[model samples]
Target: MSHENAKQQDLARATTDERAPMSTNQGQPVGDDQNSLKAGGRGPTLLEDFLLREKLQHFDHERIPERVVHARGAAAHGFFEVYDDSLSEFTTAQVLTDPSLKTPVFVRFSTVAGSRGSADTARDVRGFAVKMYTPQGNWDLVGNNIPVFFIQDAIKFPDLIHAAKAEPHNEIPQAATAHDTFWDFISLTPEAMHMIMWVMSDRAIPRSYALMDGFGVHTFRLVNAEGVAHFVKYHWKPKHGAHSLVWDEALKLAGADPDFHRKDLWESIEAGNCPEWELAVQIFDEATAAQFDFDILDATKIVPEDLVPLRRVGRMVLDRNPDNFFAETEQVAFMTTNIVPGMDFTEDPLLQGRNFSYLDTQLSRLGSPNFSELPINRPLACVANHQRDAHMRHTINKGRVAYAPASLDGHDPAATGAADGFHSHAVALEGRKLRERSPSFADHYGQAKLFWNSQTAVERAHIAKALSFELSKVATREVRVRMLDHLQQINPVLAAQVGRALGETAGDSAAAVPPSAASDKADEIAIFASAVSPTSASGRLQSTRGLSLLDGSQPASAAGRKVAVLAAPGSDASQILSLRSALSCAGAQAMVVGPHLGPLTGEIAAMATFANSSSVLFDAVFVPGGAPGVQQLTEIGEARRFLDEAYRHGKPIGVLAEGRALLAATQLGTLSGLTATAASGSSGSPAATLEAQGVLIADGSDVATAVDRFVATLARHRFPDRPLAAQIAA
Candidate 1:
């Protein structure tokens, strides 16, 4: 359609909708919404204009206070059901054991320190909290991407948060740990070593929430039908395979698209590719817990998956996105105490504190005791409770006898019996009133070393480079030294490598955070570090089966991916036809790039046209052997920018004919694997050239092969070992 016709259509649609007229609050008709009531159009408006005042007043208060932590979160609504009612042997939670039951669930995924406005691609711990509304009650499994936490004790949470957030003096850096304050705190707290190593690794910056693995950071108790108490940890394995963006890619994505993660999620759901996760648990008896080297209650550690494999219990699939982001996603509350009968809490200090903290925080933030009455927070089960009346109370009480014990009032809602009621496991407490860190919680380096050992070489290199980049940004020498010391405690080589990356020496590391001390349960440390091969790449991922991302999720295909085909105003007609058909057969979306978004007036015309889309928007690019159009591509900055951006984004490129010559002339053509060969026909144009498998050059302008190769490259997202150094030198 022409621009003029499009504008006319828009005007006509606007005119059709105008019949209803625009109205304001209180049913008042507005003469204008674009401009306020001004004294003389452009002059200052009078304060007496009530409509403008109301509009501005409402607009000013449009945003509510964001969460103090995890303010940035993406939410989805879903339903969960157990694979079997076999859990009856474990607990009396009817929902867990009832095969006919289906529970409603709301899940929120977030970044810890970032504000709601922060970049989605920042290197930070991701929060994965799920609210399961069961027949018994609401149960919230609040967790993080990494299994461990920064601090052992809950008392230091405030200080830890403050350091991780912006500096107190200026509050300059937002949602990032690349500052002096964070390093200073981490250097001071040895317990924080394990978590620090993780955040510096690739796991912290996952490709999407769909690809991240979530863990309930604290160990909890799962009581069976026989009232047998077992210590357990919950985990959510993504139905999509685990994957992460490169650190360099993440950084660029932050600037290029701050809403990258959010948009990806929204689009995925809109495309009917719903996200899913499998709920699993690591169960161990009380006797088993007593056998571990480190304290199971310590939040800053994980019972390695090898110790207890995840036993799948249920599956949660988020097939629907919320209708309203605020009411459903934002207002939905998750409380640690909202567990069913079968599930019970543990004395993991941080978990205990969080159970208390979440309710208080929600009370202050939501301004209500009745927050559970909110539609999103409300359970699918019948809610019969005595708790009522504070902040927007939506419920109506029936009886005049509000007090419990009454002769006439039959509705005395107290505990009926232990059979159907929420029951706590009969575990005795024997601790005296005292404040101290457990001797078992002090072994910080053991698991830190284990995590380091588990990583692949690429993962380790990424971590080392990340540490160097983050520490290098720390202007304070002492802070850098402190971080260096922590890294040294993790691994000497890691520390030394980062030191070289940051141009520092180990001797200068700030006095080893109150001086490293020995742990009481040092024997526990030995168990984790025993006879483990550190260099094995197979163990780094969840599975050794190819580490293929196409697993768990959809199959490999580039049907919807846009492919750019470069041809001139006067290129081969039959070539375009055969090439387009081949690409179309491959399920790729092809667009012809000629002089402009204009038609390709070549010999055999086709349905080929262009839009204003840059190369950055496409999955791959193809430069058909059109030497005539090569000048148009190179001369145009947007066109060249297309090639450059694609290179940086790591998309595939295919060039042929004089197209290769044009690439060689410009910076884009000299990229790795761009080897030129002779064209098949006697056109004297080079075509049968091997660029990269991703970047293909056909045998004498065999457009079909270039299209086939483009599809293949899209399948392989990136080429990590590209000979970029050689290409740059050329």
Candidate 2:
């Protein structure tokens, strides 16, 4: 097992231990929390009270600066193993060449705009950054869920983030970009169109971290031992297949469980269903780069899989969660510039700027350049860099030589020769320095059109809905119209829908917004990439053959899953026992929630043992048929709320006979109308029952088959098209 997995198992086990209840920082057990310590019940609190001061001080310091962007994230530990070092023609990286070697890795997944406290189910791009500690050095693949980015240049990065984050003046919204600032920026920046389509699709709201893909946004250069460089784009394809939640389901989840993504990551790792992704790259020489229509430096485009297929070089499995959330997950630092010896940077201006900025960001965030010394961020390789000393500096250089030189340290003071030292590709620079964008870095709509055309019908609908919602929030009519005009360039139907939502027409008006570009800076406004008319606005609406969630998710078995049976307080205990046994046979845990919290009665050994496992604790919940239990819970508020929240979160709702009535009594019966379109035989309309949206209802004659259908529904994550209320109950 990987070191990370072992650590996670230990952490998972630690949760079972009781660490003492509500104590002061000094370890004094508090008798009451409603009021602060005082001389008397009404007397003023004494200033000498150390416990109160300590408590308040600790509470005050509870937060750190969330990330400027990509603040919300989850992390896991893993290792990378290379396949064949056939890339000796391009990269001389030792880890890639040595098949027997393993590189320890840490990965953090995030959403670009949300704060650390934001909801996890937002429809936004995800950040997938991996830090691999190779023998030579640490290589961090800082990437995003979408293969492309919103802008081509890093100078525009601040602008993109500022726009996507909550709008200024009114901070009413959090972790969502359904406002004018984001659309206004993207509509003007044609390069953003391609990424915009993806953000609006179901892919942005992934079912879990295990079910999505990651991409290194910029094209980087890999140099071989011979110093020959080849451009490459990194990709991480999930073995479970790409998946997402329906827009409505995502919204419901925001309210049901804001930490949905993080929880999923922790639970999956602990359950022994660790997630894995294949690290691959699209490699091409200068000749191929020149042959492509778009500039190789452009971050907003991709070399379609049809053109240059990804070469699987290594695999990464995240089998463990962090032991300390603050130390490991929070303090883990990732940089785009953390490259190995053979991997080199391109003239790509965005990549160029990022190489310099990351160091500064890390220093400011981690409080020291010695951040490399942090346990989570520390590299496995030996380090002798001369750089040292800052706040919280932990290292003590053994030698007097702080700079790279010969003198005091004798034979070795650090640094190496051309054969052993890090080398940068020696490329000639002939062009005059300029402030303008390269002419070739235009034509944003082609790929945007390609992405739009690549999506399924459900995808396009989500896109349209997302655009409409974002535009609807624009306070300025002109800003709305301007955004629509740019979107119109990409697709008239999309622009028209957004325009209608904003009550305006698409046009080039003086709709410039301040705080992005300098107020005095002349806006040389021109539609750089004239958007192509969408071939058919609906785009591709069918899931790629292997993309369906129910058909694609992993494990394919119930191990740590929870099955809840709403049994009667004093009814047939045997029936419930039989039910629990069946579930246990399938490797599932079963809990019975009776009319009351105390022990209940039933007849014979058939009566099952029950525990009060709240719906919150289960991956999936079941409703076993019991006339008394079903009748009792159907009329109760907490029970209804429990089912409601579960359905809203896209968990499966299994009913046995009368369990269906209890479900219908709440607003869930409407889900029964929707059956799943199955794989085959008595399929009982698996697709209809689950509908790939947010709700799934089983109406098959057999209860076990219905349970199987419900289990499959749980695998899918959410039922997409059903009403929000119905989806939650089912």
Tell me, by lDDT, which candidate is best. 1
Model 2 per-residue lDDT tens digits across residues 211-240: 788899889988887788989988898865
- Cα RMSD for candidate 2? 10.4
Candidate 1: stretches off by over 4 Å: 1-60, 94-102, 412-418, 507-631, 634-673, 676-717, 725-730
Provide backbone clash counts, one per model: 9, 31
Q: On residues 78-133, what C-alpha lDDT tens digit does candidate 1 reach at each position?
A: 88888897767777777667768778888999888988989998999999999888
Q: CA shift at 582, candidate 1, in angstroms? A: 10
Q: Which candidate has the highest TM-score of all?
A: 1
Model 2 stretches astray by more than 4 angstroms: 1-64, 84-89, 412-418, 504-621, 633-653, 663-730
Assess every candidate by TM-score.
0.78, 0.76
